[model samples]
Target: MQDIENKSAPTLDQILSLEKQVWTALVEGNAQADRALLTPDFLGVYPSGFANRDDHVGQFADAPTMKEYELSDIRLRVLSADVVLLSYRADYLRPDTETWEAMLISSLWERRHDVWINSFSQDTPLDQV
Candidate 1:
């Protein structure tokens, strides 16, 4: 990963675009697309604990669906030339629920072989007021 440090980093717009693509894949339960965006050793930390790449993909097995979602207050921190940390708030409605749930999401992306893929992620649910 350090080898790419000398390479030009991706613009914030490009990173956000990839983030949106990831959200779209999850919302649509598109395992293939999700897999493509995640590294083989990717780990996801959710309220339920840690999930590996397969576990994350298997989450959609029952089609845990979302009716709609919006991302807000997105910001990016460049950890290194080859790594980036993306933080954002996600508000979404479940297909079976009328209320919207919010979560703070942080994802770590690494540039490998000139392509960026998500290496890690964590989701913290926000308490409702």
Candidate 2:
């Protein structure tokens, strides 16, 4: 639904803002916000397995999945006029945990109806070794 006819790539800050919204949703246990950030056919690849949009949001059924998070070493690439790939290192704490975990994430976002929607993501856990 993006004005594909007049396509334009989003700035690094714009995509970063959108990605932060997703992280904020996780920390806040905001299913609605999480769902809104992802496309209906969103695909997520994780250490556990593949997850759809619903599966991603389902973690909040009981409580927030994350307590806090920080994204760093961010990088963005314009894949097309209306698509971008954002990659970064994320350090986060889980609910009730004092320990921190880290992962490398690559997220694919597409422009739709003038809005950026996350279409895909893959998380690679940092080796504890």
Candidate 3:
């Protein structure tokens, strides 16, 4: 028998490309792109509290916390045929405190029909240097 996890692992190139689109849409604050990718029932809970798809889509507009989006060092793991997990780093410029910040982020991805959508995510701001 074969190993279940590695049976259909996503190639690094494919993961990079798809994950790049997600990050690009994030930095751009493109709600249209998010709407296309995020499931309507999506829920995201930051270290602070809970946010629905609307809140996640409007991260900059509704909250004064995040001011910028920067992504790096993304790693992907195949959880199953329909689910994938990613861990990475992000930079958030917190306007409230006039601070530049870094964070470790993990996101849950779900493949629907022919597309991958971010169903959930959480982030922890890394300590400043």
Candidate 4:
């Protein structure tokens, strides 16, 4: 854990890279890695409603998987010296799905005890036009 404030705040690229790593962990069903990236009190908002950290990580309990994923239009907003908001569009295919699904996602990362962890997240399904 590096102190971002003692150093300099992470750049957009770095944050985006971290975000991608989380997605990769999900796809690979690496619950431990995913846990490291998220805060203990993390809250996720989805079409199914709210999910806590355990709820999120528990999804990987039974050979969780993803077929493929693509991220685009990522944007980062600095909420404060220690908080950053990242928003992006994701196109992905789930394990049993042949067609791809798209969604707009926003995540909030907060620097705590020298480590950045995702504190909150929300996903909105994108309607096909």
Candidate 5:
């Protein structure tokens, strides 16, 4: 049974690769790339509050907000044939800062016109201790 489940499970490599593109956009401050990866009505929930696709892209207006990042503990769930939920822990450094911060993120990716686009995301900051 376990072997059957394993064999039937969907591969996550493609989703992980797509998620990496988003992180790369943040590190490179590429607003166009970021916008391209997200849906026009994308919604983001963060510690700072709610944000839309434009708000997410606006962070790159001046410069890159992230300097570097590492993602781990990745997991993916298929919500439907065209939708998936990707969750992971991210340790990242902000631009001009040496301190690293950690957060858990869940992003929903939906296939639109045969292309995967991020539709929703929620970020939870790790407790500082």
Candidate 6:
């Protein structure tokens, strides 16, 4: 039996929790958690390259490159019962260097099967532009 929580829509706190989980998984190199959060058809156009959900979760889990994936000034607005938008500045310490790097990140979220998942995202270097 599936023990699912009965909720009408995602609350702001719940959305934040989902985001926190993803960031936590990234920092700890836990790809399994990431896989659970991401939709199977997730796709992204990152500065590094065109990546899919499997690419990110698998690589982050296996190599463990990214560190300290922190989100600040997080603002979320509900677009609809099933959609939400989030904006925040993300900071991270590179594994190679102990320097804090940050970027402006905007993420779109969608509720599916009573779960919140990141549908799309675009990150721009905060210092550059």
Identify the candidate with maximal TM-score.
2
Summarize candidate 1's per-residue lDDT along 1-129 as a digit string, tens digits. 465336876778888899888888778978888889999999999999999999887867887566689999999998887899999999999878889999999999999978999999999999999
Looking at model 4, residue 79 earns an lDDT score of 80
What value does the lDDT take at residue 128 in candidate 1? 96
How many pairs of residues collide in each model?
Answer: 0, 1, 0, 0, 0, 0
Ten contiguous residues with the weakest lDDT in model 5: 1-10
Please report how far candidate 6 places residue 69 from its true position, in Å: 3.3
Q: TM-score for all predictions?
A: 0.92, 0.94, 0.72, 0.91, 0.91, 0.82
CA lDDT of each prediction against the hidden true structure: 0.88, 0.95, 0.72, 0.89, 0.91, 0.77
Q: Candidate 6 versus the native: TM-score? A: 0.82
In model 2, residue pairs whose N, Cα or C atoms come closer than 3 Å (at least 3 residues apart or on different chains), thus clashing, are 2-113
- State how far residue 96 of model 4 sits from its true place (Å): 2.4
Q: Rank the candidates by lDDT, best first.
A: 2, 5, 4, 1, 6, 3
Q: 3-94, model 6: which lDDT tens digit per residue?
A: 34443556768788887887888777788888888878877667887778888787774556677777789888878778888878888886
Q: Can you give the lDDT of residue 117 in candidate 3?
A: 76
Q: For residues 1-129, what per-residue lDDT tens digits would candidate 3 score against the true structure?
A: 855545455565665666566666666656667667778888887877988888777764643334566778878888887688888898767545656678898878877755677788887878887
What clash pairs does model 1 have? none
lDDT of 5: 0.91
Model 3 ranges with Cα > 4 A deviation: 1-9, 60-70, 92-99
Residue 126 lDDT in candidate 3: 88
Q: TM-score for model 3?
A: 0.72
Worst 10 residues of 2 by lDDT: 1-10
Query: Which stretches of candidate 6 lie above 4 Å from their native place?
Result: 1-9
Q: Which stretches of model 5 miss by more than 4 angstroms?
A: 1-10
Q: Please provide, for model 2 over 14-47, each residue's C-alpha lDDT reduced to its tens digit, 9 standing for 90 to 100.
A: 9999999999999999999999999999999999
Measured with C-alpha atoms, the lDDT of residue 81 in candidate 6 is: 74
**Backbone clashes (count) for model 4:** 0
Decoy 1 TM-score against native = 0.92
